[model samples]
Target: MKRLSDHTDVQLTELFTLGDIDAFEEIYNRYWLKLYSAAYKRIKERATAQEIVQDFFTSFWINREQVKIQTSLQGYLFTSIKYLVLNYKRAQAVRNSYAEILLMVNNSFDNSTEENYNYKELLERVETEVNQLPPKCRNVFELSRKQYKTNKEIAQLMGISEKTVENHLTKALRYLRVNLNSLLLLTFLFLRR
Candidate 1:
């Protein structure tokens, strides 16, 4: 067998497009470190940088057959890393903005007796509504939401089918929405502060 390391980028790409795993591995091994370092420099976070580079390579391999390399493979990979970093930064900004808003609201609520009372009442009302759900529906909803289980996990734990779990969740949500719309609206308003 020919050594993949001896092949040029264009040849590797062609081989990869033709479903050559060795060529694909050669391409990944050739570029992963450079791409990761470039991403890390831009992001300044090791884990996030690693994830971005890993995701790019995964997508590259997955789309190898359809990918159009308008420039050199090096140029294509670098440009892909650049765009991935930009997108990661943009998403991080949005998440930070939301975190700031939540922190501000939580800090404000810390000293407000009226807000605390309203929050307590809202929690009580939610509990009441949840309790009012039919037995199976309540169990499924609690497992899915409170325990944070996936539908499949809930199904396995409860000895029910995933479809049944989904049905219960849908029914529980509809009941809650109808019964607690006002409470939910009030909670939303409080959080919007």
Candidate 2:
């Protein structure tokens, strides 16, 4: 009696379709290495290539009855691996994009919420000076600097002349600049110790 290994590819296919385990085993033995090699050449990852080949065989066996071999089983399997590699790459690209976006969002959030302690203290000092301004001057400063409103927009909202808006902004900026310069000098002296 001839061994299943000696059978032709056509004979193995027929036997395998009829649920012959020995014929299936022979086909697996013949093609497993070739299939794994094809997968690895494309994916370049050992474990993932192994899994693709293993899954191909598992599906081929499970769907034997429904499988139509229009061409050789070898061709079918290599084609399957090509599609699997393409799909894996596509999935990885999508995941990488989402990871990048998430990283950008996290970095922006950190920059806003985790500012340097000394910088936060400097901002607090500026806020104290801003509160000491006359009410109209404080409102103008908050609108122009904090809310990012233009001089013309502040004049329109506050029912003041544009010149008055400009004067208030100039006064507020000059006061803050002088105070900030002195604070910076003090900070420099303290750090030198």
Candidate 3:
């Protein structure tokens, strides 16, 4: 009898779908390293890449019976990793944004006296800068931040392409970051005197 590891991918996939633990193990052994390497290359973090690969295998086994691989198992696995990487990056972007805002707030508090740390005035300054953005860019930025709409939703509401919406957002953020940093620096200098 051939070893489970010696079985062709088609045979292994068939056995896996039928809840054969050995077949599943064989598949894992065959693909885990390749999948990890691919993920690591894209994610550039060892721990995250390992976790992504582990999650893929865990889900594969859990949903074994329902998995419908129309193409080769290898193709399906690679496609799954691609989407997993995309999701990880999207989630990371959101986390990074929150972290940046938190750091900015913390630093501002550290550098200013109670009298100088006026949150309402800071918010008003931000609103003033946001209002100075070009008309369409300001609308896009407001829809995204104030209304909490997604890029896709903003694009639909404004009748613009998603890429255009993204560009407007990027431009707005760059402008705000530059302007706000300058304002903060000036405030710090004034407070020191």
Cα displacement (Å) at residue 39, model 2: 0.6
Encode model 3's per-residue lDDT on 47-101: one tens digit a residue.
9899889978998999998999999999999999988788667645643663586
Cα lDDT of model 1 by residue, 1-193, tens digit: 4588988999997898887888889998999999999999999999989988887888788887898988999999999999878866754553355346445445646547878987677668878989999899999878866786766578789898655776787677768768877766667776677
- Sorted by lDDT, highest first, which candidate order results? 3, 1, 2
- 94 in model 2: Cα distance from truth in Å? 1.5
lDDT of 2 by residue, 71-116 (tens): 9877877888788677656544533553463353334332433344
TM-score of 2: 0.55
TM-score of 1: 0.60
Choose 1 or 3, whichever is better by lDDT: 3
Spell out the clash pairs found in candidate 3.
Answer: none
Worst 10 residues of 2 by lDDT: 105-114
**True-structure lDDT of candidate 1:** 0.79
